[model samples]
Target: MNTMKKLAAISLVTAALAAPADLTASARPARATGLPAAAKGCVPAMIDNFMTGAYRSPDLTTGSVTNTESGAMLGGRRTTRFQVAGNPFGFPSTAVVAPGDKSLLAVSSGYKGPTALAVFYGLRSEAHPEVLRADLSCFKRFEVNFVANDLPLNINVEVKSASSPTVYQCGVNTEAGQTNGFRLEFPFDCFVTNDPAHPPVDWTRIDRVLLLIQSASAMAANDYAINFFRLAS
Candidate 1:
């Protein structure tokens, strides 16, 4: 599937957040020059450490499962479900608590169509799942810690806002042969949209945090271990 089309599909089905603007083919957000300096008195917050949480896995309609986990933010002990969507033709995909129960491991097999394994954050009510709104204006950037194997995978980080019809995104590409764990930082400004009329992201009304990991090729298999996702000063 085309990268832009694949991302747009995920945005539409998962949260109904909004449409995505024309994006760059490069492995980074369009119009992002570099990371900017943090603002004064900027406080740090953890989105998900993938640790210190217990969750129940329930099989979803797409043959994937949802992990209703205990979170460490938003009053601590916030219960939210992390979803796995777009597994090609119901191609088997799994999101599990990795060995040692320290990180979340997402794996996809026989990848044909773009599969987006997403982890949800912020406030949510199970009774009304679509209403997940959060305020992250206090932070200047986002930090993702994960380990990538040699397998080909396209990793994208996306954000949705309550006040706009554009979904903001930035690419976080990993080295082909690098197996070591690494941390990537993306400033909020790095997230942009091709639509100039709508804001790229409304930080104060951020409703969703989406991480998309798609197999790089057809019938390709890949896996990723996520350590944590955070917002920082």
Candidate 2:
């Protein structure tokens, strides 16, 4: 899709959900630099590294990860989903972590419309009575290390709070010409809703977080992989 159409699709998706209540129109897109001076060289809080190579089905359509690594934000669960219901091009042909590979690799086969390989964070484990949440108030941005094969990918975040079950989303796209893979930073402020009546996203009570992929063109298969995802200061 061209720039105008791509942006229009983004706006339609967010408007269908609801608008943000507390955010200003001054929000910006993802940036490579500009971290606060105090946060320079600060260690990131790990969200997932996809090191376990775990998947629920043989086709790899669904899978779960229980992060045991140190510095991970939540110890509960994270899973992948490739929703195929309204998609005419069929589900992703490949979505798995190969035996020796540490990254979660996903390959789409000419899928159309808005579909994402979603990673859900802070899932309630069997031992927990309630949904687990990660307090990310201290983090100012999200750092994602990934490679895309010239696919116009949009990285979206969905969060929920105690007062509302409604899911609010905000996202940024990978910069053009970064097909070789790059580490991009998405600041928290970039995630905003369109409806002012909707409750603002509460970073302190974050019940769930999702990293999604949206491609503008679907004429061919899309290759994407992630090495690490984190919340940083």
Clash statistics: count for each candidate = 0, 6
Stretches of candidate 2 above 4 Å error?
1-44, 56-73, 85-92, 99-101, 108-115, 124-130, 175-177, 218-220
Lowest summed lDDT over 10 consecutive residues: which window, candidate 2? Answer: 22-31
Each prediction's TM-score versus the true structure: 0.65, 0.63
lDDT for predicted candidate 2 compared with the true structure: 0.50
Q: What's every prediction's RMSD, in angstroms?
A: 8.8, 9.2
Model 2 residue pairs with clashes: 19-193, 19-194, 19-195, 20-193, 20-194, 20-195
Per-residue lDDT of candidate 2, residues 144-175 (tens digit): 78765556666666665544545566666554
Worst 10 residues of 1 by lDDT: 24-33
User: What's the distance in Å from true for residue 146, model 2?
Assistant: 0.9
- The candidate that wins on lDDT is 1
lDDT of 1 by residue, 1-233 (tens): 11233355344335532222211111121121122423442223766665555453443325334443444433232333334445556555455544345566544344453445655543233322333445578888888776655566666666766657567777655555557877777788777665768755778766556666655544445656667777877
